[model samples]
Target: MNPDQFQKNSMYIETPEDGGKNFDDDGRAKRTGTWVTASAHIITAVIGSGVLSLAWAIAQMGWVAGPAVLFAFSFITYFTSTLLADCYRSPDPVHGKRNYTYSDVVRSVLGGRRFQLCGLAQYINLVGVTIGYTITASISMVAVKRSNCFHKHGHHDKCYTSNNPFMILFACIQIVLSQIPNFHKLSWLSIVAAIMSFAYSSIGLGLSIAKVAGGSGEHVRTTLTGVEVGVDVTGSEKVWRTFQAIGDIAFAYAFSNVLIEIQDTLKSGPPENKVMKRASLIGILTTTLFYVLCGLLGYAAFGNDAPGNFLTGFGFYEPFWLIDFANVCIAVHLVGAYQVFCQPIFGFVENWSKERWSNSQFVSGEHAVNLPLCGTYHVNFFRVVWRTTYVIITALIAMMFPFFNDFLGLIGSLSFWPLTVYFPIEMYIKQSKMQRFSFTWTWLKILSWACLIVSIISAAGSIQGLALDLKRYQPFKPQQ
Candidate 1:
């Protein structure tokens, strides 16, 4: 239990002598953070609009299987996150290179070649996440607007598209918000996001239960992907739905991209890992409960016909005030969540631009460079232009691929294996130096391989389904 007693083989706090690349000039990993703050960060990162898909996700896997998969993913992600934290410190903690980003961690453990892949995966995940957020925000706006209109003009009398204007408005908000400096400045935003997450999540649970108990909503059994339960027993449709369900679970728990970033935000010290592990435990446990309750209650409330977005299943008039509030909360939360996920991307792009164009006339980006690493900061033209473009592009992608649940599955299947599963498992095995065929080592290897297999299958299923949906739904050119 002693904090001084080294844990995770190599994970430790850095000292001045280490002279590692990841630290600041002041030799501090982070100026202000605690386990509570880290928990909030993880909550905001892991539990986003993905929660909206839970009922539909469960609809694919069935009552018992869905919740079980959710539980399993939570446990697995938590454990792998711990493995990742352990790699934060090398055997000689202070002398080891500080891993501030997940890419940094991969590079430190696997070398430069693999680091590029990690960097790609990490950035792709972040962009995918930002696009996901934009889609969710637009959808939330559309839902709220429709709900209001329905209340005013009777149900089914009016309908509204998740139009281009709304999507652009959401992106404009992101374009402004995404420029909010760095993680240090986002504590308040993250806290709000975390609170908003819980607010909507709990409200969702309550509404689901009330709806079910009050005998409202479509309550027929269905296959995992919302097909009528008894109608289709054997087909690729069923198989694809099951994989999509798995991918949804992965997406919900996928925070490995920012795991080290969150950890680095903690105060630098030997007990950093202990605190991080605790923070991880807190985050995992909290999200696990939310996912289970929300998903289960959502499915129970609207069995066969649950909307991919659970709240969309609710008729506009039934719970006007609460639904509007929840949607607003969800939208606002995503505005910050978009920035949180985009941080890594910003840093990556900014650093690249600074280096690639360090001599270019237009790239006079000195505001962030000259300032002392602290709270308030200013950004230059290069920073503004690149980041704005990035946000715009991602928002456009969201509009193009607006199928929320399927997009979540594709992103999850695409990035989770590389960022969360393969790297963490490989890094853990290397750091632990466990015997190759020993029981623990063998099982871990098997688990790692299983994740790869799962990702491959999930990718095939998701891509096929997404391709079909994109063709059929044609959410193209942004509906106006």
Candidate 2:
């Protein structure tokens, strides 16, 4: 089913008389997305603020394990994503009924209590991601101000800025863009965001390369096994950081939760699963190359003292204008990503509300609003109010606890095993009717169990990190 079909139910707008030419078999507008657009959405969702933390993750895991883990997670995510892509259609891979959302896929394939669990995990992760994006965007906004301040005043001078105002600004931008109906209309935004992501990531990578080449990194400390147990951290700290680092990488590779939704946007001429598989390969390979470059180069430049965020972490103080531009790119990229992640939640809620209150005009109505130069926009009062309120609440929560790295680790670890690994694996097994003790099934189960362990330890480390940060943190206070 087309997810947007739910939104179109209450609209008073006239339908096109182009017969069935302009609509899909599901009776919604025909999808125009190809592998390229799908790749753009994947890249936008995948290479987010999580990329900035790769240096820190590498530092914690060392040269050997760092790149190895990065590659490992990339392979795992890509492999499972392909599996999930096949689950986009039910009973048959290509010529079957459509499943609109990730939850819908689970309901169609894995039914019963697992579906409920999958929905809970998926939506909770989505909400957490939006909150995390709010915090990251504000941090980048603050970084731009700090970059300018350092350029004018000096590096040693205090350049502290309050994140609350910037977060409010971000929330305002999101509140406006969140009205763009559904995922079907976000292709342009995703493309722009994909460009911005590459912009900042390239800047970070270039800066790291320059630092390594300029001999400023001669005194930088690095090790094969990551942070020193005695000098850099205690043994327990090392253990916790390694787990946290794993979680960070997991977060970096996390786009599987939305893979089905993205595939749902594709035109079905050559088959969506085939196109999505190609898109996933392209997107994941492209991102994996960048991840290796940025993570390794950043670590090579700053070594063990690498900051959690590459662009905003004050690693390079002299290139102030470049830093400002990169931060601006981050802020802009996140503006689009915020919608990509949150739109699913918005769709789910609005769709559910329409069903429950089918007769209420307030819930089921879409009024035609004529705009200047932009043409007519169908406005749903419920959507505007709900989406705006949702953004405000996320912004407030971001203001309350704005720890970036730890929060990301927590979110990634919490969502990775279930959404990225277990659900896809289970759905594939069931849909393919694989024998329980078959080699492929057994190995898949082993992989799932292994990732579950990773998730547990990663979550523990993130919670510990958050706990440590909270002990020294004051709520609503400006961070430096």
Candidate 3:
């Protein structure tokens, strides 16, 4: 198509007056992102605290089911994510009106109550993830301290530490980092977080490899079908744990909730969907490789007795400095991962408030503030208060519960089907004008329904695990 015709069809015109320098075709600031930045964001969001739990997750299902589930989730997530990337534009993948957020995409394609449902599910999942990150980061912080304590004292010494203080410290740090304007400004942070993820993941993988090669001088039994039903767990306990293990793998592969938002940051030319698809491929393959190695190797090292979080679960007490460094990497990675997830919530609320009360200065106004060494910054009062409050509330919730594995499983189960599978399938069908009950449509529906079943069972298991934990533990108390 010619430039004029393309502009008319897509509603993207670059006028001679401004020379297309400052603003994009959508009247927003020019998006400078390439697939590299998008991949970094994906990596930062995908490889998080969930990776630490994979060894335990694998142990729950044994050898055969664990690796199969990991590959299955990786395939499902990548396929659906590409579907979501296509939805970044509307009727046409390259030229239709832009849907800046996940809700926006839903509203454009599916519309009606589905949009509201999508928003509810997406935002709730996002909030839960931030809370989970808070809990995980605090655990890492506590692990660092306890690791050092174990080194100073004897390995047998009981080095108890409170997670509440570390939770507060993490919240304070988030309050400051939360001020970052939007997703577009987070590329640098995502790069750093992605590196941290690799660092800690590699360390964990290496430690596991060392343990396997060097031998722990103890028999570590592993089975093709996983933990023994009679010896390691009861029949009922095995059922629940298998479900929760699936949920943990689901959590490990989840980035679909923010996939569209990440796509929005990409510059046009090769087309956003095309760029996002490539990024998704790179990001998912990279994470899946790490997930497979970590989960398998850690399982190999610890067998059926694997701890929930190998790094922080006292799986490796010696080489104290290396363990401490890995935990620190985890904490730092979570710091950036928290922002990557929560920034969407921040943007949604701020945009809604501004539109609802357009004339209110407290809601919509921006003020200029000069800072030393950082130059001038634009401050919005409403954003400051709301974002800070959100961080504080999540931290408080983290302190109250702080069941890391259970929380991860629950959040994953709640979000995986709706945000990751169902919506994308529905949107793709609508956008492509697929015939009802067609062969392809039938298979897609089958996939969607299968995932929904997985979500339901996974959720039940997580809730059951949480209930058991709650019965035995007190709220606001240090876990270890």
Candidate 3 residue runs with Cα over 4 Å from true position: 1-41, 179-186, 261-279, 313-316, 357-384, 474-480
lDDT of 3 by residue, 298-371 (tens): 99998998888877654237888888888899888889888877887787677667768999999988899999
Shift of residue 119 alpha carbon in model 1, Å: 0.9
Compute each candidate's TM-score over C-alphas.
0.85, 0.88, 0.88
Error of 1 at 375 (Å): 16
Scanning candidate 1 in windows of ten residues, the lowest lDDT window is 1-10
Give lDDT per model, in order. Answer: 0.76, 0.86, 0.86
Model 1 lDDT, residue 444, Cα: 86
lDDT of 1 by residue, 361-459 (tens): 567544644446655567777777888999889877876778778788888888878878788888888777778899988898888888888888877
TM value for model 2: 0.88
- Candidate 2 lDDT over 1-480, as tens digits, reads 223454365333346699878888777788999999999778767887898999999999899999999999999999999999989999888998888778779988988899889878978888999999998998888888877877888879776678888999999998988888866565787788879988999899999998889976459899998889898999999999899898889888876867887998999899999999999999999889989999999998888988878776652287788888898998999998888778878888887898889999998998999999989999999998999999999999888778888888999999999999999999999999999899999999999999999999999999998888778886544443
Clashing pairs for model 2 are none
